[model samples]
Target: MVPILDYLLQRQISPQWRGLLTALAEEFETQIGQGELRQLMYRVGCRFAAAAPLPPCSSTADLADALNACWQETEWGYVELSDEPEYLRIAHSCAPLLGFGAAALSWTPAFLEGVYQTWLSALGAEGLSVVQASEFDEHATIEFRLGRHPV
Candidate 1:
């Protein structure tokens, strides 16, 4: 997700990328579904960011400019934010740069030993920061810090 969106931003900047994206997407949809497509997309995206998972930029302007060309290309097209799916919430929440970057639902303690560990591990490896808070007396609000970021 975060990785894929990052890739999408990067891809959008290039001239020949739309066709490349179309080809990649069609291949995925034909060979996979949303789940698998997401996994594959993230895998491909991580490669591009491998050189520097995080870079020290002097100001927000630098980051904005750095992202503008790419963002305008991929995200320049209209997006229907009002219509979103379940996974949309998860992707948006856990992705690196979104405003709401994480939400943890309360489950049996056993669940944490499984899903949480795996997810947190991957997120940490990717340099996302985590924040947690108890939710609705049952669930918890666990998220990654998206704005100020983490070193």
Candidate 2:
């Protein structure tokens, strides 16, 4: 996945183009609302996962560890995981979204939420939800609520 993302980044397809695509999606999402967009993306991501498949991750902790490894391998960014009693707090640095500029950054949270939600579901993680809990310059924090089912 990292390699594919790298190829996209290197090709003329460029972050700007990707950002534009995301912007279009975001614009369309406005009418549907962010939550609806997130749910839609999550379902789409699940279908994508069905086709591509993720490596086995038995537990939510293991899933987080695997994701951290996957993110590091991709060269798109680094993710540091800190397990809390209630949830997993992930500090993300240099994710590809940074290349998308300020306006497009908003698109990432819901998209990543979808992707992560799909990944967790694929791993058979019941009662789990993922969200882009917060953000700062060049950094984002993803919160994974384990053992609590999505409502």
Candidate 3:
């Protein structure tokens, strides 16, 4: 079986994101007794970045590096995640370099929009509607709804 580390090392996550990945690995290891959790991981790539718009890394280390680069190597320090510093700190520390942040680097508004769409897909939002309203200086609201009745 491809161990979690095997997958991360394949991805090219940045040093910071690498640490976060290590943390997650430890967390999973601790929860190892719960086979379901491990199974969940097996189902979803250890990095949860299968949705990334990049090439398939040839090696695990490369995958981690690519993922890390995709996360931390954004347009300067401009990202469009939760504005809350506390939350942003947690997310920013490991969040993928996308949305406004990626746009910052590529200067392509769609890059930012792409990130937003990716976020929606990651959250399993099928048939969902997101209304975005920009707040001064990269702040925006994403109003959404579920496709079917809430479970």
Off by over 4 Å in 2: 1-40, 58-65, 72-75, 140-151
lDDT of each: 0.32, 0.58, 0.36
**Top of the candidates by lDDT:** 2
Over the full model, what C-alpha lDDT does candidate 2 score relative to the true structure? 0.58
Residue range 1-151, candidate 2, lDDT tens digits: 2555445544523555766776676575557765665566567656654555568976657766777776666564556666687776656555565344445555545555666667766777667777666653522434434346456
Clashes (N, CA, C under 3 Å) per candidate: 1, 1, 22
Pick by TM-score: 1 or 2, better one = 2
Candidate 2, pairs of clashing residues: 127-149
* Model 3, span 47-143: residue lDDT tens: 3444555445554354345435665654222233332322111112212322222222222222333443444445454554232233112222122
Model 1 lDDT tens row, 45-91: 44433432333434434434433433344353221111123211111
User: Regarding lDDT, does 1 or 3 come out ahead?
Assistant: 3
Q: How well does candidate 2 score on lDDT at residue 33?
A: 67
* lDDT agreement of model 1 with the native: 0.32
Q: Give the higher-TM-score candidate: 1 or 3.
A: 1
In lDDT terms, how accurate is model 3?
0.36
